[model samples]
Target: MSKLKVLGICGSRRDESVNMKLLRYAGSMVAAEGHDFEIFYFDDFPLPLFDSDEEAKTGIPENVHRLKQAVREADAIILASPEYNGSITPLLKNAIDWVSRTSARLQVTDEWKGKPVGLCSCSPGAMAGLRGLYHVRDIMVECGGLVISEQVSVGKAFEAFNEDGNLVDERTSGFLKAMISKLLEVSQALKKA
Candidate 1:
């Protein structure tokens, strides 16, 4: 079988954000499985907040269109978000709003419809990344994505990795490996559907 094309979306602006490192590790895991993984830093992508007026005047932000195009092209998606006051970050929500609107090439229905998605989150707090993932999972569903049920919520993210951003904690590594395997399983199964 051919390799699965996975896209990792990091929903944080901090260059050293824990979510970014988590997604990077996920990409490595997918590569080890003989698949191709690409990381899309949502922060670096210049997308304005969704506005009907702006769309009417400027005709969709080129960068937003490109980001949605990437999402549409990918066979699977891994979204890594950070919790803010017990919910998904505004940046991620804004991006989702942009992608969910009607568009020329990548409408929400066709772009995200039935595409498999795996959700994950990272936080330095004890609650882990669960809350953010939960919020994103709902958004994915609204976009018609097939979300993998077994998601990951990384807690105390500062302690979850080494100084070099490598996952050093044995328990956390095992948990992440399991999550990646499950994501690959769902993604592979969806391809045959």
Candidate 2:
């Protein structure tokens, strides 16, 4: 089978964000399976708030273009989101909003169309950011992404990781692994077709 490129997107911007840690751990697992994994943190690509007038005048921002390229290149995407007020974080929503706009050169959503995706979330709260995954899934579907059914939600995220920043719970780890495997399987099938 051909090697697949997996992109890990973390919605949180904090230096020590639990969501970031979870994404890193997922990347390690994907790498061990012989797939290339790349992590994209929201903090790295600082995009201006999406504005139709600004886009009409300036076109898509360079950073947004780069982000769109990354998404287009990756065989699958693993999204690690932290719920904010029972919905997706603004940082993540903003990034998606920017990417959804049509560009002069590309349909924009074309990059996401039929793309395989895995959703995961981590939080200190009991919901484990699970509520936000629903919103994320809806948005991705609207953009034509094929979000996998399996998902991981690590609750009490403050204690979800150990000293090495690895997931401490076997169940959570297993769930993430299943989600990644499913994503790879679906992506490979789609690529062959």
TM-score, model 1 to reference? 0.91
- Candidate 2's C-alpha runs over 4 A off are 104-109
Candidate 1: tens digits of C-alpha lDDT, residues 1-193: 6688999888888968899998888788889989999977665677887878777777777787788888887888888889898888988888777777775543333467788888888899998868777888888898888888878778888888887677877777777778788878877777777
Q: lDDT values of the candidates?
A: 0.81, 0.88
Task: Report the number of the highest-lDDT candidate.
Answer: 2
Report the lDDT of model 2 for residue 143. Answer: 87
- Runs in model 1 lying further than 4 Å from the true structure: 103-110
Q: What is the C-alpha RMSD of each candidate to the true structure, in Å?
A: 2.1, 1.4
lDDT (Cα, tens digit) per residue for candidate 2, span 124-173? 99999999999999999998889999998999999989988889999889
Query: How many collisions between residues are there in candidate 1?
Result: 1
For all predicted structures, in order, the TM-scores are 0.91, 0.95
Residue 35 C-alpha lDDT in model 1: 95
